[model samples]
Target: MTHSPQLWQPLQYGTAEWQRVYFRLRNAIEGMNGFGKDPLYECLESGGTHRIRGIAAQAVLVAFQLAHANKRKLATWAGSIAVDGNRPHRRATRRRKTKPLGSWNHEGYLTEPSE
Candidate 1:
C-alpha cells in the first residue's frame, strides 16, 4: 500500500471501543449481507473510525464503518448509493423508467428548463 492519503484515516485503532465496534460491524456485514466469502474482506478489516464532513458525511461514515467491520464490496456499494443519491444502474434498464427532472420554484420564480 502506498503512503498517500487514504479514503479514511484512523481516529483510534487500538482502543477497546474501536475493536468492539469493528468486530460487531464485521460480523453484521458478513452475516447479514452475505459478503463473508468475498476477498476484499481482509483488506477492509482494519479497526478504526473515520471523520467525514458534508451533506452525506454520516451516511458515508456508516458505509466505511460497515466496510471496516463486514464486507468491503457492500460497503463500497453503500458509499456509491450515498454519493449518487441512489441512482439506478445503467445495465438494468428494462426494470427502470426515466422521468424528467422536477421543476424548481424559488422566490416566486419558476425555473423550468426547456425539454
Candidate 2:
C-alpha cells in the first residue's frame, strides 16, 4: 500500500486540531516572554539603552536571562513540592509562634490585658 503525502498534510487553519495546536504554541511562547520580563529575570529592563550594541552582547544577555528564568522556575517547582502535604517526600518544618498585636503593651498604653 502506498502512503499519500496528503495523508500527513498539515491541518486546515480554522480546524479544531489546528486551533488547538496554534493556541498551545502561542501560549507557550507568551508565557516564556512573560517569564523573561518577570522581576527575577529583569533582563528586559536591565540596560540603559533599549537595544544592545552588538549581536554577541544581545545573545549573551538573552542566554543569561533564559538561564535565570529556568533556575527560578525550577526553584519554585521544587519549593511547591517541598511544601505540598500530598507529597510523601515533603519535609516538615517547625511553625513559628505568633502573637496578635492586641496582646502587646506599647509604652504606657496597654493594647490588651496584661494577665
Where does candidate 2 clash, by residue pair? none
Error of 1 at 59 (Å): 24
Worst 10 residues of 1 by lDDT: 42-51
Regions more than 4 Å wrong, model 1: 1-10, 33-115
Please report the candidate that would top TM-score against the real structure.
2
Question: What TM-score, over all chains together, does every model reach?
Answer: 0.23, 0.53
Global lDDT of each candidate: 0.56, 0.73
> Highest lDDT: which candidate?
2
lDDT of 1: 0.56
Clashing pairs in 1: 26-69, 26-70
Those runs of model 2 whose alpha carbons end farther than 4 Å from true positions after fitting are 1-10, 45-52, 82-115
Would you give me the overall lDDT of model 2? 0.73
> 1-115, model 1: which lDDT tens digit per residue?
6555765556468688888889998997666554533345532333333345665975676576555655555555665553446663333336566443455465645576778
